[model samples]
Target: MDYLQYAFFRNAVIGILIISVAAAMIGTYIITRRMVSITGGITHACFGGLGLGYYLGISPVFMAAVFAVTSSMGVEWIASRYRIREDSAIAVIWSLGMALGILFVFLTPGYVPELNGFLFGNILTIGTSDLWAFAAYTVVLVTFFALFRRTIIACAFDSDFAQVSGLPVRFINYAMTVLVAVCIVLTIRLVGIMLLLSMVTVPVLIAETWSRRFISIMLAAIVISIVSSLGGLLVATIIDVPCSAIIVLLQVALYFVARIGKDISLKRPIR
Candidate 1:
């Protein structure tokens, strides 16, 4: 609780919550639609955005957002039309993006200290500006999701049928890609690029087994993520562990408990 007294700590907490809500909401669709790998791909590609930001000396978040969206679109275009497997295409793009990011960083003035921060995240270092940016982005994401719920649900459950019904499947897919890009970019400040995948996947994984309805899953995911965020902050504060790592650990523990509960409930007693 004392840790929360610091202004930056407070901002960090708010930033993390913003990230959790966005990740949880979009994560539901990502997991249900089997786009988990793409989440990672988009995350790694944000490194290229980091590099671009370094080169341009602008906010990395801005460059990351641009790179993530462009990369997602590129992956979508290739996956939609080419014979290449989605996984293969993702891997190819992921590698190329990272390579370019490294080149850009190395070419910059001095060794970038923020590079490592972007890799693993440094939530405790969040600033007021970051908090505001996160809040604004979250609003945009929520509005996007709310307005496109029907189309997204249809496409997620059945793309071929959505296309047959003239639901603008391709456009919706691209829009989802943009949302994911936003999600990835939003997270870099809170969880970093390397471990952002956990925030995107863990809550959704727990909710999937516990809830059957979409709204229920999303609500559960949000609750789980918020709890994990608080727990992670406490654990990191007391133990001096990295905030992002603690967050992932808390999510893992929750997943195990959920799994264990399921196993116990499914067990049969001797007759």
Candidate 2:
């Protein structure tokens, strides 16, 4: 309780909550569209931006965002226009981005003290700017979903049908690719690149066991993410462990618990 007096702790709590909401909403879309691998690619690509930012003495998050968005858009464009397979494109981009990051980091002078934070995350370092960014992103995501829920759903479930039905499938796909990239970049501060994919997917997986409907899963995921993130943060603080790892481990534990409950319910006789 006394730790609540610290501004950094308060900022972390707020940042986690905001990030959990936005990640759950966007993660629902990512999972529904089966773009989980693409999301992972984009997150890895951000490492290139982070390394570049460090080499250039600029904001790593901004650089990471740029790399992420570019990588996502590049994958979409290459897969749609060129003869390359989507998975191949993702693989190329993933490897290229990681290679670029390593090269940049190797070339960069000085000790690069913040590199560990970007790789593993330290939630206690979340700042006011991060909170503001998360809040703004949440607002934009909520508004987008509210305005185009049906179209987004149609595109997610069946893009061919969505295009045939004249629902701007191309536009929606591109926009969503960009949105997912941004979401990954934002969440890097919470769980770092190594564990971010799990952060986005675990809650969604748990939510899926409880509901098949998209909206219901999104809501459930939000609640689950909040609980896991907050609980992990608190436990990490008490035990003096890494917050990001604790958060991810907690989510993984909950996923197994959800899986067991789901199995038990399926085996139970109906009344």
Candidate 3:
């Protein structure tokens, strides 16, 4: 209970809630469009920005956001206009980003501190500034979804049909890709690059087992993420384990439970 009085703990809670909401909302689109691999590529690509930031003495999170957005848009351009396969583009960017990050970190004069935190996450490091940035992202994501739900849905399910229907499919695709990149960067501090993909994918998978509707999945994922994150935080604090790892483990455990429950329901006799 005394820990609740600490500002860092409060900030961590706020940051996780905001990240959970954003990741859930963006993850629904990623799952629906089958862009999980693309999202993973973007998340890894942010490491380049992190390393560069360390070398340049700037904020790594900001640089990570820049790298992620650029990588996402670059993938879109290369795949759509340059005649490269999407997966191929993701692979190129993923490798290049990691290589660049390694080079930059190696060149940095001093031993880079806090690199492990970005790699594996430490919720206790979250500060008020990070919370504000997350809040801003959440607002932008919610506003975008609220204003263009139908178009976004159409694009996610069938881009060709959406384009034929005059829904600006290309524009929606670019916008969502950028948003996905931003969400990845924002949440990296929570779960780190290594485990960030699961933060976006696992809850959505569990939610999908129960509902096919996009909004339902998003809401369910948000709830599941919040519960798991908070519960993991509590357990990690008590056990003195890595918070991010604990959170991911909790999410995996929930996924199995949800899967089992889903299977049991499917086997039950109809009334």
Candidate 4:
């Protein structure tokens, strides 16, 4: 409890809250749009970005963003040009990107212990630069989401209708990819590439059970994310546990509780 008053804990809470909100908002569309698998492909591709950073001895964040955006664009290009199933395309990107990433890292000079952070994250070690970049990305994501709110709803509800109404479905889809890429880059350093999907999906799962409206669900997800972040950090500080695991565990617990409640409600008799 005492550590809650500390500046580092406070910043961790804020950063994670922003993460939850951003991921949940994008995740809603991701799940509804059946893009979860594609998102997974991009997550793996982000390893290329991490490898690029290591090879150039530069900031991983910047390198990750570049690789993510490029990979996302490549996916978009392929999906548009061929009449192939997205799953196959995603599979191709997933395997090749990861293989290339590993190759690049193997070729890079020197032994860098921090490389593991890309795979498993180093949440406790987040410094000022990470926090600032997170805040900037959060603002940008929120702004984009807000501006395209109606169109996104339309696309989610009925892509045919959205397209008929003159909304650029392909462009919006591309935008969504870019958004996910940005989040992937921002969060890989905090939650790692391996555990990133949990952070993105768990909060949204809880919110979907409890919320009636899209806005409410997104807001609820943000709150859940914040609570988990704080709880995880507090536990880590007090008992020296892994913060990322603690945070994810907390989300899993909340998800089960919400699922159980839903099941119970469905079984109850209504007047």
Candidate 5:
């Protein structure tokens, strides 16, 4: 295809694959540990970083990473030290980040271009530089998953048990929180802040209908995300529609199909 000759097309493919893998891993942890809203809180918080980056004329990605990590850590600190509800902490951070972002973006002199791209996303605009950054981060994420698979699983299922077993529960939480923040920032460019949460959540939900094992769900989610995302990208190119929305829709459709399949299996007679 003529599109393949274009660097942007190649970059989009590479970027989506890397993101799918990273998101599947992070999504597993988030779902297992019930941190979906925390990740969502981090997503909204990254918008402030984008506004701050525009205000300061620096890389939006860098500022977003900072906001994400801070938001995540802040939530942890508030909930643990002050005995506040985690959801309440998330609410505070979420509002503050969005408010600060709006303030900074307004304070800047010119009309901000590329802001919408960060908000709604444009997969077609991804470049080699984006791909490289995603690749580096994915490598680190994979290494983390590989090294701490058992410990991470322990923490996810029961932090109390893990702590009592002499595992560094607190340290693992902080590390995973940092990793989750970084994943959120990197994924922002893919689906933007608006739809990014689904990219991390939907595929895992689809996988859960049929599998109960942690690694099984993660691996199945990675495959489902890749298939749906790539399929959506190709369809978007063909129809001239938004890729991210299409991708999410496809994953959601798969979720329904998986649910139906599960129901059907339950009604079948045992051999």
Candidate 6:
């Protein structure tokens, strides 16, 4: 409670709430579309942006957004345009992003800034600008979801059928991909590049074990994310532990709880 007095802690709380909503939405979509692997690819791709930004002495978050979006789109582009496999494209871009990141980092001049914070987590140091970026992205994501709920569902569930039905599947895919990339970049501030995938996914995975519907999963995921995230923050302050690890651990702990409940319910007598 006392930690709330600090502006950075307050900013972290707000960022967690805002980003959790977008994360739930995007994570649900990713899970539905079976594109979870791309989350890792995009996360790594943002490292390229971070390295580039550090090398150029610019804002790492901004460069991360650029790299995240470009690499994500690049994966889709090469796969669609050149008939390359999607996994193959992801692997190539993943490697390229890492390679570029390392190269740029190594080339940075005069005592390079420590990137471990960006690598592991930055919630404790998140600023007003980062909060604004997350808020803006959340607004855009909610609007997109609201306007095209059915279309998004159709595309997520059956892209081939959606394409056959003239539902603008390609547009939806690319649009969502870009949205996802930006979301990933914004989220890096919360849990950093290494652990962000779990922040989005572990909640959705827990929610999935509880509900089958997309909306249910999304709502449940949001709740799980908010709880685990905020709870992690507060608990970390009390125990002086890392917020990212606490958040991830809480989410994983909830998954096991959900699994236990599910197993127990299955053992009950039929109604």
Q: Which candidate gets the maximum lDDT versus the true structure? A: 5
Candidate 1 has an lDDT of 0.87
Q: What is the lDDT of residue 5 in candidate 1?
A: 77
- Candidate 4 lDDT for residue 30: 76
Candidate 3 lDDT over 1-271, as tens digits, reads 7898999999988898899999889889999998899988998899999999999999998999999999999999999998887899999999999999999999999899899999999889998888999999899999999999999999999988999889988889999999999999988889999999999999999999999999999999999999999999999999999999999999999999999999899999999
lDDT tens digits, residues 1-271, model 1? 7766789888877877888898898899898788899988988888988998998799887888888999899899898789677788899879988998988998888768788888998987888877787788789878877888888888888899999998989988998888888878878877888789999899989998877777789889999999899889888988998999999988999999999998887795857
Question: At residue 243, what lDDT does model 2 achieve?
Answer: 94
Model 1: per-residue Cα lDDT at residue 221: 97
lDDT of 4 by residue, 160-214 (tens): 8899999988888888889888988888867888888888888888888977677
Candidate 6 — which residues are off by over 4 angstroms?
none
Query: What is the lDDT for 165 in model 1?
Result: 94
Off by over 4 Å in 4: 4-7
Clashing pairs in 4: none
Model 1 clashing residue pairs (backbone): none
lDDT of 6 at 220: 95
TM values, all candidates? 0.94, 0.98, 0.98, 0.93, 0.97, 0.97
Deviating ranges (above 4 Å) for candidate 5: none
lDDT of 6 by residue, 23-131 (tens): 9999999999989989999999889999999999998878989999999999889989999778889999899899999999989987655588888986878889888
Ranking by lDDT: 5, 3, 2, 6, 1, 4
Single out the weakest 10-residue window by summed lDDT for candidate 1: 262-271
1 versus 3: better TM-score goes to: 3
> For each candidate, what is the lDDT?
0.87, 0.92, 0.93, 0.81, 0.94, 0.91
lDDT by residue (tens digit), candidate 5, 1-271: 7888998898899899999999999999999999899988999999899999999999988999999999999998998899988899999999999999999999988899999999989988888888988999999999998999999999999999999999988888999999999999999899999999999999999998889899999999999999999999999999999999999999999999999999999999999
- The reply for model 3, stretches above 4 Å from the true place, is none
Higher-lDDT candidate of 3 and 6: 3
Itemize residue pairs with steric clashes in candidate 6. none
